[model samples]
Target: MVFYALGSKFIQEKKDRENTPPKAQEVIYYSLAIGHHLGVIDCLKPQITCKVAEYDAWIAQLPIDGEARRKLEGVKRFGEINIDGTHTHLLAVALHHSLPQMTEQQQQWSRELIALLQRMENEPAIYLLVRRHDDW
Candidate 1:
């Protein structure tokens, strides 16, 4: 479900890039990365052993610079040690970048995504699932 939402946003961002300013495009890229990280946390399953591979595929498709790439690499590393904390930090950074320029609808979606992240943060089962995998 989260993945679907992320995919939709990614498509929209791609389409919007033509009209978007360079700085705003950077925000969009960060937002996509944050969304992907959240999607990974949401999609974790005990039977799945290829989560890191999935993440790598997604990362490879992103058109980000070295700094953004490093930030995402940090997301993967920190997620292994602390999924909730890492997600919170990444989401906050993405939001800070994107919020000032977002349309009302975009802001609403961001709010919903933030709520979802908060809910997931409180789920111990999700944390355990994250810890069970080191492939990331």
Candidate 2:
């Protein structure tokens, strides 16, 4: 959310984390949602963080049991895709850098973002490839 708010130079990235444990994901979300307090000497650049800690705290306290509560207890990161500002600007930027060999269309690329980047990363792929690409 805040990343796109910063600007429009985003490129899609894919990762496979099929075996990542739930606790690790929870810790990541908690870190983002409840952002760290900056030191006075720190730089003032805008930080990208989920603005949903209060809601998450409330949800965590609800009367629920077992996996349901555990899932909610995992911090829920929130994002709102700026349909006009971010998406439109991204479309324009991509078109500006478009190649003659590529079929660039705003209609194809400008769909409203509908889910968390983390969720997209963890989703099972429709097809699997044996080749491995190392990220690190």
> In candidate 2, what residue range of length 10 has the lowest lDDT sum?
124-133
lDDT of 2 by residue, 1-136 (tens): 1223111111123233335566765564433322322322111122232234433433333334533334333323222221222233333333334323233322222121222222223431111101111221
User: In model 2, which runs have C-alpha deviations exceeding 4 angstroms?
Assistant: 1-16, 36-136
Clash number by candidate, in order: 0, 0
* Cα shift from native, residue 75, model 2 (Å): 23
Clash list (residue pairs), candidate 1: none
Q: Of the candidates shown, which would achieve the greatest lDDT relative to the real structure? A: 1
Write the residue-wise lDDT of candidate 1 on 1-136 in tens digits: 0122222333354466678787776775455445444755443333223356554543343235533335445536655432343565465456446555565644564565456456556531222122324543
Candidate 2: residue 27 lDDT (0-100): 62
TM-score, model 1 to reference: 0.32
**Residue 111 alpha-carbon offset, candidate 2, angstroms:** 13
